[model samples]
Target: MYRLYYAPGAASLVVHWLLIEMGQPHALQRVDMDARQQKSAEYLALNPNGTVPTLIADGRPLYEAAALVLYLADRHAEAGLAPAVGDPQRGEYCQWLLNLANTVQSPMRLWWYPQDLHGLPEDAVREAARRRVEAAWERLDAHLAARGPYLLGERVSAVDFYLVMLMRWTRKMPRPGDAWPHLGALAGRMKARPSFAALYEREGLSEWR
Candidate 1:
């Protein structure tokens, strides 16, 4: 069984939702942020970054939500959440996932924790990060307009799960994820899934539903 170290509705939610989507058996170990449990030696031993959504797979710990999703999707190919290796779509699949991580998700770090980036006024840094996020949404919205109902178009993939959760993080922003037409439609479809409702219950998330 896989084990996930997470905090409710955090980055861990993506992994949690994917596992349920794949019908994978997993155990959750919450790292209490209120208690600073993530910084404790034990938790740091498992994940040096002390971040949520670390998965322990086959007795080894894995960090990074994107990597974990990639691993799980590939390993459980029968779930059909990833394009198989050598499939023509595989390259595009990797590109979308990596773009989600490197382009948008990195900026999310600064958006959520402006204190991490030094030297500038925190508010300015946050505003800059917010712009980056909105730009990402605009690009993604266009992509969805052309190629989506899901990220892979017609068939849902793990990348779609990742996208929905990332968009959820932006729910409180000035122009939220759903403000874009395609993204709004995509979010609506994703939310209609049984797994999404279960995630809301599992994470105790009452807002943005």
Candidate 2:
């Protein structure tokens, strides 16, 4: 069984949701962010970065929500959340996944935590980050429009779940992900999943719901 250290509504939500969706029996270890527990030396040992999520997989520790989710997708291939190695859409899957990790999620992080960037005024930093984040969503909105229904065409993929998680992060933004109609529809579909419902319940998230 996997042991997941998480903070509700944080990036860890993606990994937590994946475990539920995949029917994986996992233990939940709460990292109290309100008390700054993640920065403690003990927590650092598990995840040096002191992040909300540190997945203990078969005695090994893993971090990074996207990576953890991707790992779970690959581990539980029967879930069909990821395309097989030789599948043509596998390339597309990797591209979209990595792109979000780099471009989309990156800016959103800076937007949320401007202090991480330092020096610049917080407003200026968020203003710039906001445009980039919204543009990234605009690109995705078009992609989803063209693809229709899901990120990988007809069926769902882990990437769609990942996208939904990110979209929720943008809920308080000037133009949230759902502001883009296609993305809004996509979010609607994903939120309907029992796994997502469980995530909301566990995380005590109400706004994005």
Candidate 3:
């Protein structure tokens, strides 16, 4: 059986949703990040990075949400969450998944914790990070506008999960909806999925709506 260590609201949600989509039997261990449970020796041994959403399968631990989601999808190809190796859309699928991590995800992190990225006080750096986030959101909005539904057309690939969680982070920012209509719509669609609804219910997250 696979074991998934997760913190509520963390990138681990991507893995959790994927596992549920795949219909995999897994144990979910909630690591309390606020309590520093992730930094404990046992958790660190599983993942030295001490990050949630770590997967332990076959006695091996896998970190990083994107990697875990892709691994689960590939392992259970019958679930149809991942494109086959030779499929034409495979390239686009991989590209957008990684792009979400490298481009959209990174900028959101900067906005969330500006002091960590800029090595300055939040008071001194928040505005600069917010401006960068706004510019990034504008670019994301335009891209989504051109693409229509889903990052890669109609199929709900792993990229959607990443974007769903990332966009949720944006809702707390000033005027997030006003700045990015496409992203807001995408988030709404993601939340509408039964899988996401089940996850929210299981996680006891009343704020998902």
Candidate 4:
């Protein structure tokens, strides 16, 4: 069994969702971000970065949300959330996952906590981050329009789960991700899954549902 250290609605949400999706046996330890429990020495021992989602798998601790998603998908290969290693679509799978991590998810930190970009005006940081995120939404929407109901086209995979989670983050943005027609449709399709309902219930998340 795995032990997942998480904070409700944080980046850890994706990891927790994946565990639930894959029907993996796991337990959760909620890190109180508001109380700075994640920064406590004890939590730091498991994750130096003090991030939510320090997953204990096979008696070893692992972190990084995207990595956990990929790892879990690979571990539960029978679930078919990822393309097989030699499948033609495998390259695209890796590409979109990394793109989401690098292009979209990285800038999200600035949008949420602009002060972290020290020495820059918070407003300026937020504005730039917002544009970057919106541009990603536009690009993804076009891709969906041209070739998808899912990111990889015909099949739903781990990437869709990851994208849906990120899309939910944009729900309150000035120009939300779902404001794009194709993106809105994709969001609707993903959120309709029973696993999503289970995820929201488990995380105690009511918004963007």
Candidate 5:
């Protein structure tokens, strides 16, 4: 069984939701981020970065939510969350996944913790990050409007899970991701999945429900 170390409604939400959706056998160890448990020496050993969503797979520690998403989808190819390696859509899959990770998710970190900039004006940093995130949402919404019901066309993929998790993060933002029509439709479909309810219950999340 996989052992997942997570913080409720954090980046770990995607990993937890995937586990539930894929019907993977897993156990959870909720890292109390409010109490700084993720930074403790014990947790640090499992993930030097001291982040939640540290997963134990085959007795080896794994971190990074995107990498974990890719890993799980790859290992369980029958779940069909990822395009097959030789498929033409594979490149696009990796592209959007990396885009979500690099462009969207990274800026969101600044939006949530602008204090990470240290010496800079937190407000300026946050506004810049917010703009970057909104640009990403605009681009994605257009992509969906033109070519989607799902990011990968007709079928749901692992990236949809990643996307919805990020969308939920924006629920409290000045302009939420779901404010975009196509994005709102996508989020509705994803949230309707049975796994999401379990994810919310386990993570104790009520917002954006």
Candidate 6:
């Protein structure tokens, strides 16, 4: 059995959703980040970064959302969240997976911790970072618009899980809905899934609305 350490509204939601979709039995351990439970020695032993969504599988700890999803998909290939290595779709699948992690999610970090990325005390610089995030959102929105439901059309691959988390994070920003209608719709579709609803209820994530 796998043990997943998670927190509501965090990237852990992606792994949580994947586990549900795969119908895989796993333990869900909620870490209270506000209470600093993630910083404790016990949790630190699991993940030095003090981050949520740490998965302990076969006594091995797996951190990072994209890596976790890939690990789960590979472990349960019958789940169809990932394509076989030789398949043509597999190339596109890997491309989008890396794109989401490296391109999409990385830029959004600046908006969250502008001071950490650039120095503090400059309203103009903050606004510039916000604009950059918005621009990235536009690109994602266009990609979704072209692809039609899901990042790869019909199949809800691991990339969809990545996009779902990204969309949720973007919703909290200023002018939230201005850039991505398709992406927003994708998030809504994922939320409507029974698995997502069940996880939301279990994790007390009703505040997501």
Model number with the top lDDT: 5
lDDT of 6 by residue, 55-110 (tens): 98998998989889888998899998898889878888888888878766776766
lDDT of 4 at 71: 93
lDDT per residue for candidate 3 within 5-38, as digits (tens), equals 9887788988888777667888999999989999
What is each predicted model's overall lDDT from 0 to 1? Answer: 0.89, 0.90, 0.79, 0.90, 0.94, 0.81
Local accuracy of candidate 2 as per-residue lDDT tens digits, 1-209: 99999998888999999999999999999989989999999999999998878999999999998888789999999999999899999999989899898878999998899988778899999999999988898888899888867888997999998898899899888888888999999999999999988888877888888
Q: Give the best candidate by TM-score.
A: 5
Candidate 4 CA-lDDT value: 0.90
Model 1 agreement with the true structure over 23-69: per-residue lDDT tens digits: 88999888899999989999899889988878999999998899988
Task: Give the TM-score of each candidate.
Answer: 0.97, 0.98, 0.90, 0.98, 0.99, 0.89
Worst 10 residues of 1 by lDDT: 147-156
Off by more than 4 A, model 2: none
Question: What is the TM-score of candidate 3?
Answer: 0.90
Candidate 4 C-alpha lDDT tens digits along 13-117? 888888888899999999999999999999899999988889999999999989988999988999999998999999999899999998789988789999998
Is 4 or 5 the stronger prediction by TM-score? 5
**RMSD in Å for model 4:** 0.8
Candidate 3 collision pairs = none
Candidate 5 residue 69 C-alpha distance from true site, Å: 0.6
Those runs of model 4 whose alpha carbons end farther than 4 Å from true positions after fitting are none
Candidate 5, residues 80-108, lDDT tens digits: the string is 99999999999999998999999899999
lDDT value, residue 153 of candidate 3: 73
**Model 6: number of backbone collisions:** 0
Give the per-residue Cα lDDT of candidate 6 at 137: 71
